[model samples]
Target: MIHAALAASALSLSFAAAAHADPIKIGFIGELSGPAAAVGQDMLDGFNLLLEEQGGKLGGHAIELIREDSQLKPDVARQAARSLVEKEKVPIITGVSFSNVMMAIHKYVTDHEVFLVGSNAGPSQIAGKQCSPYQFITSWQGDQAAEAVGKYAQEKGYKKVVVLAPNYQAGKDIVNGFKRYYKEPLADELYTSLKQMDFSSELSKVTAVEPDAVFAFFPGGMGIAFAKQYAQAGLSGKQPLLTTFVVDALSLPAIGDSAMGIISGGFWAPDFDNPQSRKFVKDFEAKYKRVPSNYAAQSYDAALLLDSAIAKVDGKVGDKPAFMAALKAADFKSVRGDFKFGNNHFPIQGMHIMEVVKDGQGRLNLKTIATPFKSYQDAYHGQCPLP
Candidate 1:
């Protein structure tokens, strides 16, 4: 009986040691090429900052990141997701750059019983009726920043404005969010092609109407072209420009002289004025030799979130229920202040009116001007089933 007991104790200790020492596989599907590569690369850098600090381990388990580029193509992203799920058998996935890519693999990721800690791309469809328990967004919903912009416009009493987007799901969501709070009707609502680089025709349309403000949402390289063209067309000084996810660190260096004093709404800013945020900014800049954008900030939070949850479960990530519960608990301090999950698993966080300006060192950067929404939940959370 004593020998049998000794053998059983040895087996239990071996199992515990194996669990602690095992390497965890995480799928990183991102837009590593194309116009959005800056976004993806920054997210990876930010996530790596924490992981590297922990000696490439989270919750006492070595992390093995399996990276696959979506190349900003839906089909490519879908196939990558399939491979990660079926072949790699990763229990967790993160680093989706664009909303379109998120849409491509949302069903597959959740249906396969995988946890998706979305670093970006929070479209309305997944946040509402089709919300999944397996999906947790570390970033704000797609429309939250636009909603903040809308609220700012409403507060300023902008009676007439024009709206422009890329005519995609995310663009539509941003437009809808803008219209929701801006009580007044728009002067002109125009959507250009996603690949439409020359905004001359769109600019002509805007110039014809001549509104008090213009709200535009053209991300990645499209945004860079649009901003330059808008400036070149002599509309930058004439009309007040409001934007979402555009006038940030990623685009500012390219935007040059025209980026100054441009206004937008976002959740994170470099000078966010918090210990957590300051530390992240300092360390990230030290490592990357560049300014970190909101995308990077969101991805860093995802890593902190995973670390906290994984530690709680004693590295037994294979146990879905415990891992899910640990995620729901959100036992981590976010780089962004006041973060929590709604019933829909999207972040219930604050939004602020952000502005690009030259700091004391003559560097243009996004700075938080006003906090409009305090712990604002997305409009579609009511449609989720997790009441």
Candidate 2:
């Protein structure tokens, strides 16, 4: 029995050594199944595109992508993160879908001393007191988009607005963000289940309140589901719906005609009218045969961020401090036009309030309405420890 145990331990050690000897592993953990799978798939596609462009390499090491399907569950995300950091020993982890799942996996990454590159899922805690030097967000925080929406709504003289969200940390952040800028009276504040797809009851509640506009922050599949239900319940035409991160490409196509005339706040869109953005839009459309969502753009930016870090470190990924410094410097061509890192390692980039407009051919496109804010910073940045 002692000999058998010795043999097993030896095999395990050998496997570990072989893994280390192999290519550099980067983890992509998100919802690869369920209704939100398209978002994860787009993120993976964009990340893979970067890898392919770089010939599947970074820092003189062959790139090996480790994908984990969180199924959009926090516990599942935590398990995947543990496997990546503890078992696989990946240097960097990226592409978490839900905010709760990101929160769940954050402790593990910080504790294990692994760098986390966030593609989506930007929780306020990561930007605030719980912020870590090891964590860098490739996208804006949860409230930035909603803040833009709020600013736009205020400018448009929207009063007595109704807010709908999925009763979570992200939801609260978005609502608070809107309220921070929107001094108007709130007609209703409705919270539904995190997993709730049916918003009929909530819509009914909104109808009763009769707000001038409705703002929401439903991400991923929930966004698609909620938008569809919102349209079916005739709220789309009845009331002016303003949203952020909810009516993105992932749900826009699903919402079809219902998505048309919908106004939302965004940091990046396919028709952003920048050279880098044009290239990304064309290439992603050719490769994926569909419009790339904001998640995809953020994922592509994450890859570029890693590439920049690797270049700055001169093929020495072993130096975590140097890599982190490069990331903090924000020395990459962001597909989102302009890019800079905030004090909290979150994006300090331009935010636009966009409306979904259909072209002559009836193809859905985002049209910029107003540049309510530019190069915005998250409210929690002052509270972060990082420079």
Query: What does each candidate score in C-alpha RMSD?
Result: 2.2, 7.0
Output the TM-score of candidate 1. 0.95
lDDT scores of the candidates, listed in order = 0.90, 0.85
Candidate 1 lDDT over 252-335, as tens digits, reads: 999988987688988889988888999999999898898888888999999999999899998888999999999998888888
**lDDT of each residue in 1-387, candidate 2, tens digit only:** 999999999999998886567677899898899877887888898888778877897645578899999998888888899899889989899998778888899988977878899998888998999999888888889888888889888988987799988888888988998898898988888898887888888888888887788998787778888888888877887788898877776677777888888889878877788787888888888887888888899999998888888888875666988888888987878898889888888999888888999855577878887887888899999989877
What stretches of model 1 exceed 4 Å from their correct place?
1-20
Best by TM-score: 1
lDDT of 2 at 354: 86
Cα RMSD for predicted model 1: 2.2
